[model samples]
Target: MKFLSSLFAIAACGLLAASVFAAEQAPQLSGCAAKRQDITTQIENAKAAGNAGQQAGLEKALSEMNANCTDADLLKQQEQKVLDAKREVSRRQADLNKAMSKGDPEKIDKRKDKLAESRKELQDEQEKLEKVQPDEDDD
Candidate 1:
C-alpha cells in the first residue's frame, strides 16, 4: 500500500512538471489555426455520419496527416506530443495493473478513465493534424 502510494505520488509530480514545461514551450499556431479548425470540422462530420468503414478510413487519413504535416518542426513536435501522451498512458495502465493485482478496485477504475482520456487526446491531436492538410482523395 505504501509503495503504491509512493509510486502514484511520483507519477503525479512528474506529470505536473511535464505539463508545466509543455505549457511554457507551447507552439504558436496563429497562422494555421483556422485551417486546422476546418479540418477538424470535416473529421467530426465524417464521424457523425454513422458509417463505420468511412470512420475507420478517416482515422487512418488523420494519422497520415499527423505523420506528414506541413510545418517540419511543428510536425516533429506534434509527433513527440503523441509519443509522450502514449507513454504516460502506458505508465498509468501499468500502475493500474499493479493496483488491481493488489485488489484496488477504485484505483483501477480511475486508471481506466485516465487511459480513455489519454486515447481521446491522441485522437484529437490526429484530427487537428488532418485539418491542417489538403485532402487528396475522397475515401
Candidate 2:
C-alpha cells in the first residue's frame, strides 16, 4: 500500500511538472490542434485526479471535436467572440461616460477599471480571431 501510494504521488507530481513546463513553453498551437490538445490535457488531468465525471465530459468534448469540428465553423465562432467583445467594450465605454458625467472620482475609477478589463478581453478575443483566420485560409 505504501509503495502504491508513493508511486501515485510521483506520477501526479510528474504530470504537474509537465503541465507547468508545457504552459511555460507556450507553443502557439491554433485551430483544431489547439482545441484537441486542450481537451486532451483536461482529460488527462481529470483522470489523474480520479474525477470520473470530468474525464467523461472531456471525452465527450473530444469526440465532438473529432466529429463535427470544422475550420469554417471555428472561424465563425472566433468572429462572433470578437463581435461580442466589441459590444462589451462599447457598453463599458458607455458606463465610463455615465460615470464621468456624474463627476464622482470613485465611480469614475471603478468604471475605468471595468472598461480596461473589457478592453483587454476584447483585445485578447481579437488576437484569437486573428489566429483562427490562418486556419480558415489554409483550407
Candidate 3:
C-alpha cells in the first residue's frame, strides 16, 4: 500500500508539472502581431508621404499598440476560451464519428450540425479579431 501511494503521488506531481508548463507556453496572438507589423509599415508610408492627417492616424495606431497591442493578459484569456470551445467541438465530432460507425444516421446528422455551429462561432471570433483596426480615424 505504501508503494502504491508513492507511485500515485509521483504521477500526480508529473501531471501538475506538465499542466504548469503547458500554461506557461500558452498560445499567443501571432495574428495580432502580424497585423501590428503591417500597421507599422503603413505608418512609415504615411510618414514618407508627409501627410499630417495620415501621421495623426499612425499615432493613433501606435497608441492602440501601447494600449491593446502589448496587453497579453486579455489575449491569453480569449485564446484559452477559443481553445476550450475547440475541445468541446472535437468531443462532439468524436461522438459524431461513433454514431456514424454505429449506423445511427439521425444522430450523425445532428452532431454534424452542432459541429458546424461550433466552427461558425470560432470563425466569427477569428474574423472579428482580424477586423480590429488600431486607428479609429476613417478618412
Better of 2 and 3 by TM-score: 2
Model 1 Cα shift for residue 76 (angstroms): 1.4
The order by descending TM-score is 2, 1, 3
Candidate 1 lDDT for residue 130: 59
Per-residue lDDT tens digits of candidate 1, residues 39-108?
A: 5666788778876787677677666666665555555666677788778778877877887898878988
lDDT winner between 1 and 3, please give it. 3
Q: lDDT value for candidate 2?
A: 0.91
Model 2 root-mean-square deviation: 6.3
Q: Give candidate 1 misplaced runs (Cα > 4 Å).
A: 1-70, 133-139
Model 3 Cα lDDT, one tens digit per residue, 1-139 = 9999999999999999999999789743344665576678788888899887988888798778757754355456556667777787788789888989998889989989988988887776665444442333534
Per-residue lDDT tens digits of candidate 2, residues 47-84? 99999999999999999998988878998999999999
Candidate models: Cα lDDT each? 0.71, 0.91, 0.73
For TM-score, candidate 1 versus 3, the one ahead is 1
Q: Which ten residues in a row have the lowest lDDT in candidate 1?
A: 27-36
Clashing pairs in 2: none
Q: Model 3, residue 121: what's the lDDT?
A: 79
**Winning model by TM-score:** 2
Candidate 3 lands at a TM-score of 0.42
Query: Alpha carbon lDDT of residue 96, candidate 3?
Result: 84
- In model 2, how large is the Cα lDDT of residue 21? 95
